[model samples]
Target: LEKKIAHQDAIERNAIEGKFGEGKRKYGLGRISARLQTTSETVIALQFLVMNLEKVLRDTFLSFFQIWKALYLFVNRKKYTLIIEK
Candidate 1:
């Protein structure tokens, strides 16, 4: 049980760390050059917000594409069956 819990914790930690690493590398989270504390906090918050929005957009697009592909294949399958019978 202890080993299973440790493994689960490591998996969660890796995912969290990967998100932070992605933010630092892509969203400018690592380079907050603000003068005031509030300004710095605001910058960090905005970066995280942007990251979350991007994730949502990406997931939405992926779901849309999958649905579209399935529909396309379903329609095409009927057409192919008709052609094969004729």
Candidate 2:
């Protein structure tokens, strides 16, 4: 097919720039896998934590996210800080 040939041509060109490695330079598998590797993730703002609560409590929400990212966010509901990872 025209499209498949064009895609193969593009992959061959991209693989040269990708310069994978002697072992990784698998032409057919490399080209096909590269096409399949374009997966993605989506994150919804979900809601702004600040907008729902009183001004005095804004600090708490900011504190939660900072601390959560620190822990890689294991708990869905976390209250009190525990320095799980540093």
Candidate 3:
């Protein structure tokens, strides 16, 4: 049971750490140069916000693409059958 719990914790930690790593690598989280505390906080907050928004946009686009692809295949399947019958 302890090992299971440790494994689960590691999984969660890796996910959180991966997000930070992604932010640092892709979103300039590591390059903030603000000297003021408030400015630094604001920059970090904005970077996180942008990351979350990007995730949402990507998920939404993928969902839409999947739905569109399904509809297209369904329509084409019927057309294909009709053409074969003729």
Which residue pairs collide in model 3, if any?
none
Give residue 68's lDDT in candidate 2 (0 to 100): 78
Scanning candidate 3 in windows of ten residues, the lowest lDDT window is 77-86
The C-alpha lDDT values of all candidates are 0.93, 0.49, 0.95
Model 2 lDDT on a 0 to 1 scale: 0.49
Clashes of each: 0, 0, 0
Which scores higher on TM-score, 1 or 2?
Answer: 1
Count of backbone collisions within predicted model 3 = 0
The candidate with the higher lDDT, 1 or 2, is 1
Best by lDDT: 3
Model 3 regions lying over 4 Å from their true place: 1-9, 82-86
lDDT of 1 by residue, 22-78 (tens): 999999888989999999999999999999999999999999999999999998896
TM-score of 3: 0.76
What are the TM-scores, per candidate, against the unseen true structure? 0.73, 0.22, 0.76
